[model samples]
Target: MVSSTAQPPATKRLAGRTALVTGGSRGIGRAIAERLGREGARVGVHFGGDATAAKDTATAIEAAGGTAFTVQARLGKAGDAEGLWSAFDAQADGLDILVNNAGVNGGQVRPAEVTPEAFDHLFAVNTKAPFFITQQGLSRLRDGGRIINVSSGLTRGGAAPDLLAYAMTKGAIDVFTMTLAKELGARAITVNAVAPGVVDTDMNADWLRASAEAQAGVSAASPLGRVGVPDDIAGVAAFLASEDSRWVTGQWIDATGGALF
Candidate 1:
């Protein structure tokens, strides 16, 4: 007999939809792709140079009874968006959700230590790629599609001075989210940004994984009393991709565990 508290088998909320998540080979991108796949969307897990991790993410999605395929394209270069969409078109007809989750942290370059080349590359991958990717993808993205841009809490200020350039890119992304939402509203599509704080990922391994004291310090920065995980951000993306967020757009949803406050 079914227990009163036991829920029914999960329902596929995104059945028959198609989603493409860049940098989906690991970390938050991986979690987002897997979550979307579990909700029944055929996921395109895009990776750069990491075929093994991409395959692993796809395998995990399939193992969980979802359909997924890997797409490879190195962002931050010329024609990167075209290459990505060409690969995407080979597998799916159109897009229902586009998660621009790929980016670089620009290392630890302060204002005095920053180089022009480094700054250019940071914008190329973090800002320029997503801008054009979405531009070209507008035709393939069906009316009412969801476009989720992964921003950062650093844009809100109060972060390290060395992250200045990185924060600037995210600031641009926030502006992109607002303007695109207005432009795409006519088609019922939603454009929004999710700004996550210091998440526990390979990107921050030098500090977060260094020692217990460092871990405690990072965790204490958040009111939640713990480091943010990839899944913590993925849960927010899933909500934005669903019908429930149809009424939400042109906004930056801070997933910073109250660090911004």
Candidate 2:
């Protein structure tokens, strides 16, 4: 006897998984966090500051029928990675997915104008933080888990000269991704990088929306005739975090909507 009111079950690919997304309070990080939450992962939304934003992100996840918590820690400082993990430890016993998405653009400093201070800051947040974070997180991350790094399309050719320092940091991330994937292969932990091109996030809204010309220029850059949204990158991150990406490792996925091509 089939019931007339019977409903189809919801899909929760990440059910029972625990994930931590750095900078998850906003931008692409928030998108990834929300998507993972929808997939049924108990997500730890990490933020540097802006407790309010972090709370909002957590609320959004919970509102969507997912479990979420907030973790606050300022990265790029001494012992920052350890402190971040400590905060996460207080809430969750282990981690199944780690997304290193926190980073800074280091302004628009060209190679000639780049200073030692700016370079250090850029590398600290974009490179060193992720490296040490991963080092400390390995203890908490369970085997067969996932590690997804948010890289930039600027690391590829045709990048603007003004983005030299910023791109260098992401370049290091690419190397880190390949090397770490090899090292972690024994544990069945897949490591990959998701490279996005000119995503329309709050960070880029200032310039990207400055004028119709600006907007059109960006849209035209992609063969798809559109600018990328945070969800565009999130979808790729979600795939990398899921069991479906088990065989995909050590690859730098281009999420640029064919802009590079």
Candidate 3:
């Protein structure tokens, strides 16, 4: 149901748009931040760790003649999400795009083995934070603005037994995006999700380091020979943020390089 012809001029398409990308210090989030900045939008990079990485991302944006700032926040903590908005808003003023890209795989624990604390924390970051964060961003996001929730292809592709909890969280992301898009549709704010396959991010790189077998297994199982890269997801994210996808909403686009198929 996306109207591809609804595109606007590139120069003014996302100009003046301010975006907040959570867990944006590295990986897919970093790619999204850089891409949006290149498109003439003010960028807010949110990080849970590696302050240096966050600063580096912000610096890269500035170096490219774009405005940007960084904020550190732990989505696992209660009230931390509210604080994140305060800092992000102070830096960028208002938001036009919000990318919920901060997530984890529950540290390779199976759902049956996951403790209450572990499972709760995963949902807090992957599902809870985006829900409340987007709620907070509503006042700031302009009508016809964008929201891109980062999910995982594992929900449909089936996760390794150890990744069940992580897949569960991503499932919530899809439902959250669909329901919220309907709720916000009246205002023209388009809500959608992008589910990525195994991407060559710092996150996956760590997992690859921990278990090369697992990494090799994923690559071999994929329809594409290799894993995905950050730019792969970033390009799709940029389209969601731009006027090119103004009429798109309430759905999840799989950016898994056909891994699920």
**Could you tell me every candidate's TM-score relative to the true structure?**
0.95, 0.95, 0.90
To one decimal, what is the Cα RMSD in angstroms of model 2 from the true structure? 5.9
Clash pairs detected, candidate 1: none
lDDT of each: 0.90, 0.91, 0.83
For model 1, how does the per-residue alpha-carbon lDDT over 91-173 read when each residue is reduced to its tens digit? 99999999999999978878899899999999999999999999999999999899999999988845589999889998999
lDDT of 2: 0.91
Candidate 1 lDDT:
0.90
Query: Candidate 3: how many backbone clashes?
Result: 0
Arrange candidates by lDDT, descending.
Answer: 2, 1, 3
lDDT of 2 by residue, 1-261 (tens): 111122223369999999999999999999899989989999999999899999999999999899999999999888889899999999999999999999999777679999998899999999999999999999999999999999989988556999988999999999999999999999999999999998888888778767678778878878888788887888899999999999999999999888898
Q: Model 1, 8: alpha-carbon shift in Å?
A: 13
Residue 138 shift from truth in candidate 2, angstroms: 0.5
Per-prediction backbone clash count: 0, 0, 0
Clashing pairs in 2: none
